[model samples]
Target: MPYADVNGMSLYFEEHGTSEDTVPPLVLLHGGFGAGEMFQPLLAAGLGEGRRVITVDLQAHGRTPDVVGRPMSMEAMADDVAGLVKELGLPAVDVLGYSLGAGTAARLAVQHPDLVHRVVLVSMPARREGWFPGVRAQMDAMHEGAADALKQSPMYELYERLAPRPEDWPVLVEKVASMNRRDYDWTEELSGVTAPVLLVFADADGISPAHMVEFYGLLGGGHKDPGWDGADRPASRLAVIPGATHYDLMFSPLLVPVVRSFL
Candidate 1:
């Protein structure tokens, strides 16, 4: 278990493939209430030779130690990521973050644009006014002794398909419990990202069922500046996996080709 002392916490991470394989390392960030290991399916899908993969467990989750003073703000998470990359001597890397991780990745690309070459944001929430109230309420409910809600959640159904059994339930429960409530903002951070972006989501994903329209609309609205100079904004790609939800699309056979084409 490799660990990096970063941002007042011991961050856990694993490196796969080799830096020699790709020019820029691929940094993988998992979903909310998920550890970096969520990318395992993608890794097994065979992303190709010479593509190094670095998966990180955010602080206080998985094998990482929680930072004592800092709440798990996405900004802090981004800083942790930046520190890890610098500590490991990585020059620049491509970033792939899913769900909550996607939000953090967006912040990173905006705040530390020079450190990222390309970015893939999967199953992210649409940045619309008042869009997060319901979701936040649900998460808050779960945190405030409504743990039973987890059993009825759409995400739980997806998790069941991935890891079924009473024994595995604790892993999922701990993940939800460990999530920091304050780190769920994407409104002000989305516009600052400058990396070539790929947005991937499923049509029926509970968190992002209408994500394609909203996400692509944001990209094309011209209201958002990609933080690039005139005429050189990194291109964006939007892909909606048909007939799949969030959990299903992760291991769905369709995702591989799209990922390979972009990354």
Candidate 2:
């Protein structure tokens, strides 16, 4: 129930573990459609004892007040996050972000590199030219309930295959609806980032498998296959999660170890 007023918005946050000197802290930035509590189960399932976790509700989502400025770009969100970290008096913290959150994380690294010790981007898309227009169109059509639109969306297909349940659809729909359609660019910020990054993706993620690979490559991060080759880049790495789709990747058991290794 704790909230910090940042830039005219009430940002809600939850903390876990002990904030002692022995334990380093981790910040969890959810996808645009997700809330701070999305990672709740991970906290209880033994994410280690000495680590502290801070989960936040990004603007206009969950318990946070909507950010009325600049149509919700990743840069704008990153500013809000930076302000929150300062308010909390954290000198530096590791960041773990998924999908939309990944984009925000990239912006944060570029804009405020000093505030982040490490960064992780999961299920992200490339910011290159002409990469995501088709994907965004499909999602828009589905959002408007166009005929067979849902069937056409790779996101919906992946979600069905991975997290299909009567109750899950509503949550998914709500989250997608929360996205600010104007703020979805990350290409400009990727190259300027100097922080160590861990890029993760699922083989079956219909939403952005190809774009993810492209993004991985642009970061000078080396993928096992078909991604950017950064054999010489000392601070970046790419890992593909087998047998997992995008939705499934969120709940995958490997997330902890993957994120922990990077931190």
* Tens digit per residue, CA lDDT, model 2, 1-263: 78988877778888888767745588888875567777787777655347888888776556665543335567778888899899999888888888778777777888899998888888776553323466556555444333245445654454444331423444445445545344455665676677788888877764466666666667775534433774455577777888898777888888778777767
Question: What C-alpha lDDT does candidate 1 achieve relative to the native structure?
Answer: 0.70
* Residue runs of model 1 more than 4 Å from their true location after superposition: 19-22, 126-137, 144-188, 207-211, 221-234
In order of listing, the candidates' clash counts read: 1, 1
Candidate 2 Cα deviation (angstroms), residue 7: 0.7
Clashes of 1: 1
lDDT string for model 1 (1-104, tens) is 68888867777889998757347988998876567777787888886347888898875555565554455556678889999999899889898888768777
What TM-score does candidate 2 reach?
0.76
Off by over 4 Å in 2: 19-23, 68-70, 128-134, 142-185, 207-210, 223-233
Question: In candidate 1, how many Å is residue 34 off?
Answer: 2.2
Clashing pairs in 2: 217-228
